[model samples]
Target chain A: MSIIKAVHLRKRFIVKKKEPGLKGALKGIFAPKKIIINALDDVSFSMKKGEIIGLIGPNGAGKSTTIKILTGILQPLSGEVEVMGLNPQKKRAEVVSRIGVVFGQRSQLYWDIRLGESFELFRRIYRIPDEEYNANLELMDSLLGIRRLIDIPVRQLSLGQRMRGEIVSAVLHSPDILFLDEPTIGLDIQAKRNIRKFIREINQKKKTTIILTTHDLGDVQELCPRLVVINKGKIIEDGALDAIVHRLAPERILQIDTDKVKKDFTYPHCKMIKCEENKMWISFNRENVSASKLIAALSAEVRINDLQVKEPDIEDAIEQIYGEG
Target chain B: MRCAVQSWFEYPLEMLCWIIFIPLYSFGGLLLLKVISTQFSEIGGWTFHGLAFFYGLGIVTHGLHVIFFFAVWHTNYMVLNGEFDRILLYPMNPFFMFIIQSFNIAGYIDITPGIIIFTYACLKLNLDWNAVAILKLIAVLIGGTLIRTGIFMIAGAIGFFRDTRNAVTNFMVDFLAYNTTAFPLNIYPYGIQVILTFLIPVGFINTYPAQDFMGMDNTFSIPINLSLCTLLVGIAFFLLAYGFFRFGLKHYKSTGS
Candidate 1:
């Protein structure tokens, strides 16, 4: 069953435009130019329960706008958004109660209080039963090891610790759906690994539906089986992660080390991209020329000592998607 | 509320400054009342004690306004900085969240001097302190707070439309609330009195309520009882202002990330 759906969502913003220099500043006081920005234009997507979907896009591609609209923090100019069979805008309180949100650059925790106290406040705000709240906290502590950091003030916690606390705070009520915007923005490798593991465990243990937006392809590559690519306020591609990667970036680079130098090496269906000294880099589509076949052909022309085939990653696919736009 | 109190205690030096400065500020108003009393028996048919009562009422209501509605002052900054986005994400009314999140405990210091002056004035006036009168006083204080808060809310809601950076709020607080409401409305010209009483309704905060205690006739020909008018006006104005706030929320354009 579809747990969340958005149809033809459109949102725009009117911003004041100012010219350069002091004279323009003075003129702006009386007659400032206004420009309209279509932040989201005809964007649509859907998600089923317990599915981890990655919403990836370039900057200003309306990734955050779409999340805000789903969370009911923003009202789209025109759209139909239904979360758990209810309109998020019309039934905001009910919709918000069933879902959780975390903006990587923004914190929902009180800065002056201990992390535990912030959780306590969230309990009251959501009106979570004491038993359920305690159970959730214990689960979070077991999974993320958040018990020791609870006593520390939120402002004093390092970014990774604070992010963990933020995730705990978001899930204290056991929301059915979680929307994460850039969750692993600035964490170290170990912290990112821990967070990714925690997210996986939560999804498995609670069957929580997750929709994450991020620039980190590692997050998408590891956590999301499905990928939705957006650029310029529109959906560009949406499908299985590997399927989209293959469709957009199918070519692989084959690097060869040879003892003897060949003045000219030519092969059908393959192009030599780079060569220096005893090494040569060749590019060919996997569908057009198999790596083994190309290597077999290359060994006959030159004394190839070693070779490595580099597969195309999501980063390259994403770059290609953005470059096309 | 606990968090706000804890944060307050964390800034000991700042708390000490507020403790000392708030009462001194109220004292300055009292000194002005003293000067007016010496020069003339009454500014607008109000005796020294009666004027003191009115001034004390204004101070108390002002302090309460600061205590309860202090968050309104930061609405512009919140909207501009994307802090309001976080408040909207909570599973509660955004307005309610905004109020409780910034509950200011230090405003208690502001209330202290006002209470002291009010009690002193009550003793001097020797007014009847019956249950009904006490209830009326409570009603007046509550009504006055609602009036101030309503006006401030209107000012703050304008932030949703444009970035005023508290400019409109400052004008409302300094000129309309403190300077205008502190004195007898009758002292102003008739046109000003009408504007204050009915249009902006700052006069209802203290002037109309005090008139009943001072045995003065209703300056305006309004049919409602003078004693109950403040509460009625307060409720009506607050509802209207809140509706305006809701309208602004519909048009709220959160800052871009």
Candidate 2:
């Protein structure tokens, strides 16, 4: 059974039509106009109990809107949404207790208080049992090293540290599902790796269903097994990571670095894409041309010093999907 | 609340200014009172000490409103800045969270002075201190604070519908209610007194209850008992304000990512 479901969700916003210049501003105050913006149009998707689905989209693609509706922070103009067998709209408080949400662009921590104090506040708000709260704290400490930073006030922490603190506060209640919106944004390599590891550990240990929305392809590549690509308030494609990648960009690239000048060589199964003084690039469909067989054919013609095989990455596949739309 | 207090105290200069200004402002009110009483024993059939009691109620509740409902005043800013989105995601009641988050201790500076002045007024006036009087005082304080909170909430909720900030919030809370509540309501014309008594109900803060306690004539001929009417008006306005807030949340379109 799906843990989270959104079907035919539609939402529209009435934005004021602001005119330009001082005269226009005065005119707006006297007689303003408004236009309707379709924030989400026929957006639909479903996720299983323990799957981590990366929801990727271009800016203004309704990615955040979908998360907002599913999390009950927003009410769709028309749709059906269920999180953990409860309609989020009607049962917001109950459903929210069963889920955790983190927005990387916004921190939920209390700015004036220490990290530990924020957690304690959440503890009382959620009314989490003592054992469960402490255990979750220990788990978060192991995964994100939350203990060392507990004494520090939120405003004093760096962006990376604050993001980690945000994640800890979100999950301290052991929510069955977690929604992370760009959780690894604006982080260094080490911080990103640590966050990714923490997410993976949580999912594995507790079977937590995670729906991550991110523009950073690295986050998608590292954490999400399933991909739900959205564009212009529509779901373009949804499936396993490799399946989407293969369907969008079927060909892989093979580069050969030889000792001396190399003549452009082509195999019947593979197409030669580029040739330099000592390197040659070939593109071939993985389904038809086995890497071993292609390498054997290339070696017969030239002395290869080094070879590298490159599979199509999530970024290229997502870009191609977005481009098509 | 503790955290908010600590953050304010972080700047010594600001704290010093607050400490000094609180008393200075109270003394200004006393000076006005002294000037008026020196010329005449009473302005509107009320002694200086009696008028001070009314002034104390308004000032103390204003201080409480600032301490407890500060978030309501800033709700517009939060909505415009998208900080309110944080409040909506929490599992608990968002209104409760907003109230708790707004608890500020700096208001204690203003409240402390009001309490000191109120005690002095009661002693100087030799007012009755029976259980009934104590009960009436508690009821008025709660009702008055609720009225202030309702007005502030209504003001802040306007931001949820429009992108612009309105000046009515400042006019109502700062000038309209604050200035009117400190003086005897009877000093104004009958029409104005009626509006304050029945329509906006700012009179419930100190005017009607103070009149009832001091055995004076109330401005409005309320159908129900004065004490009950005061409490009910406070509650009714508060609930209406909360309902308006819920309505506003339905249209709360959070700003940029």
Best by TM-score: 1
My TM-score estimates for the predictions, one after another, are 0.98, 0.92
* Chain A of candidate 2 compared with the true chain A, TM-score: 0.91
lDDT at residue B223 of model 1 (Cα atoms): 76
Cα lDDT tens digits for candidate 2, B148-176: 88888888888888775545566666666
Residues A1-325, model 2: lDDT tens digits = 8998889999998877879999989988898888988888898888888889999999988889899889888889998998998988778889998899999999888887788988998898899999999999999888999999999989999999999999999999999999999999999999999999999999999999999999889999999888898888888888999999998998899998987735657677788888888888899998888999999987888898999999898777887998997
Highest lDDT against the true fold, candidate = 1
lDDT of each: 0.88, 0.85
What ranges in model 2 sit over 4 Å off?
Answer: A256-308, B5-12, B37-41, B166-168
* Candidate 1 residue-wise lDDT, A1-325, digit = tens: 7999999999999888998999999888899999999899899999999999999999989899999899888888998999999988889889999999998889988897899989988998899999999999999989889999999989899999999999999999999999999989999998899889988998999999999998889989999999999888999999999999998999999999998756578888888899888999999999978888888988989999989999999888998999998
Off by over 4 Å in 1: none
DockQ of 2: 0.56
Clashing pairs in 2: none
